[model samples]
Target chain A: MIPVEYMSVILMIVFGFVGMARKFPRELGATVAYTAMLFALAVFGERLGRIVYGLLYRGNPEAAPDLALVQWFVILAFIGAWVVMVYAGQTLSFAGKWPPNAVTGLVFDMLIGLFNGWIVVWTAWQYTHRLGYPQQALGWFVPPLSERASRWVALAPLELIPDGQEPWVLGGFLAFLVFLRVVR
Target chain B: MILSLQHELNKLAFAVLRPVLGGPNPAITPPTGASTGAGVGIDGQVVATAIPMLGADLSAATLVLVGLAAAIGFVRGVRREAITLMVAAAASLIVGWMWPAVASLVNRLWRMFHFAVIERGILAENPMAAWGEAQASAPLLPLGGDAAAWQIGFFVFGLLILGYGATRYVAAPPPKARGIRGFSVLLERVVGAMVGALTGILVSRFVLPRLVPNAQVALLGPGTSLYDRLAPYAPTTILGIVLLLILFGVTGIGGGKPRQKMYQ
Candidate 1:
């Protein structure tokens, strides 16, 4: 199999180009906003899912659907939130008084896009490699699930510079590219 | 100061990372052996547990608040005000760094002053008894706790100052007056940079330390001494300023003339 880390790097590079081509700070801003939202979901999503399950089932664990169903709901919610945030960001960027100018906005979008793209890839890698699935992965905050989940997601795929540092390298390169574009 | 900062950072890190690292679990679950309490989880095991009421996990709440703030800042075009805000933020970090000593000194002075008054008053014959009585009575000042509280208070105060400064600068009358416009813009930039710097420092001190614990000591420097911690953040402060300058230099920092298209 192609190294997962390499796959992430390739994903980041491709995303970087997409970001540059979009060339709107709002697009970058939207990505950041989405990332933040995703982070919130990752931290709280599972709990929310359980709460919904509890309220619906009313203390009857058997009344709830299988674990996979709950996991799918959480995953779908995450995707929904991402879509909403991106759309909201795009709308606000046009409606609001940010980015000041087109060129600056484009640069801002490009840089943020690069950073965000890396974050997505990293999170995905963590999901596939660390946690078996999105629900179990994000549910790691809870002790019971974490104990069970650790067996599957504990080991990181071996990489050249540790999976954590990939974004910085990718972002820095993207920033350099923007700087060159501006100065040139 | 370092210890307190570390404590706060640990809390923040656990809040942010636990969910990401650990799988789905209840926000606050009682320890395996305990009926109720606060505790720290290490590697999937609860290591320390305390009063259940105090054990409420605030990480999710904090994350939400931070996310809101970040969204607002980005939406408000706060980056446009980066230069001035960075400077202010840097200054705030230095103040936060020195706050422990300042708080200690103030505490000493207050105690001495209180004792002096007690000694000279009607309770002069039994000062210790009078001090005890005073302790029993409601405090004259509502202030409570140690340097950590004061440090947090100062951090909030700095944010308020920055917020107010930014609002005033942005709301200033257009440069219709002779030389006033140029001066106003200059002041706005300064204030904006200061706000950005203060926000940066707050993030560094509270959020960054936990997210990147290893980078924390490096950013704050070696040793527990205030100078050591304060000196390292200076680069972060300087970098904020430099970033603002570069941002403006390239973007041409809005030359006072209104653009024809608002969303270009």
Candidate 2:
């Protein structure tokens, strides 16, 4: 009932804009409009999430027990992706051209978008399934000897998550690629 | 962020309203920067929505009227036109603050006396019901209250960004470099003020309603509110140079002259 998949639909639009922005930065007035829309969308998503949770669980998930963990991961994941998508999409759109030629550019953009979408969905699923449990303790979940611990704990994988706005920079790069393609 | 935003809003209110109160109009010369006014009515709505909010408070209201009066004062600065500005500002302040309720009442009266005319139009069958429904669908946020404050914050942030941008890309040497004379300077200022006023009217009447329809809900005539304001809003044929100078290009109209003496 929460319609967790709603996030996917939003991503689709974000990527769609990225694809379009590559070809039409000035015409679309997209660089700013898209960013503004994404910001507005984030607020809307939170409100929608609350509404969905209220309808599904008959109570606000933010205030409920055993649901807080799910809420945290789900909400954070959505926010993280939401921000990243804008940065990524904008980069791709603004660049407005493809490498070497149009065919190569379009193909490369589609491939990157596809992969980005996959990674986002996969990470979301992991969070939804494993981290979704409300009572699951954080640090103890992975044993010291276990593979999860060695990679996630010992390697400290979360550190690899780039700092704020880095993804947006990447998004700008992607936009440039699109711009090159469309402008040519 | 909130404090800076609020301060900038206050400053802009001062800049914009200084004209209305019979003050010298320190006109905003538009620059020929990229015309980004294509369809997205953000700027239009931002400026249009600002008026009602400014009118909500006495000081802020005075600032907007003063800004307008400043614009009207043209080459003459605020010092020369104090009396005219005060009367104009006071009148506009009263009108702006009271107009919403007054307009609402008038609209209600029009509906009553002109019921036949109202019904004969597109919504002839159930005009009142449709009007009620439209009112019901108004934005959840209150007009000219907290939402307006948030909007003002955003507007301030935008202006800051725009100001920084202007400093970077749009600043140009004064018209002295272009070799214009006394008559040309006067013409430029007059034309610029007229252009800005026209832009204000067109934006207030059209483009603004579309981008932030709900924000300008109180302004639209009844027939106008039936749909999105964005769809119909279009840029006026403001002269290219004036528009450019207003947004980004600076002509230094007030440059290097002895400040005119205040009216004795």
Best by lDDT: 1
Candidate 2 local lDDT, A39-72, one digit each (tens): 3433353464455456666754456544455464
Worst 10 residues of 2 chain A by lDDT: A152-161
Q: Is model 2 an incorrect, acceptable, medium or high docking prediction? A: incorrect
Give all TM-scores, in the order shown: 0.31, 0.20
Per-residue lDDT tens digits of candidate 1, residues B4-41? 65456556655665564342224334457866434567
Candidate 1 vs. true structure, TM-score: 0.31
Write one digit per residue (lDDT tens) for candidate 2, span B58-172: 2223233334533753443112222222233333343344545544565555555444453453456777775654444434223343333444333334333442223223333
Error of 2 at B48 (Å): 90
What is the C-alpha local distance difference test score of each model? 0.46, 0.37
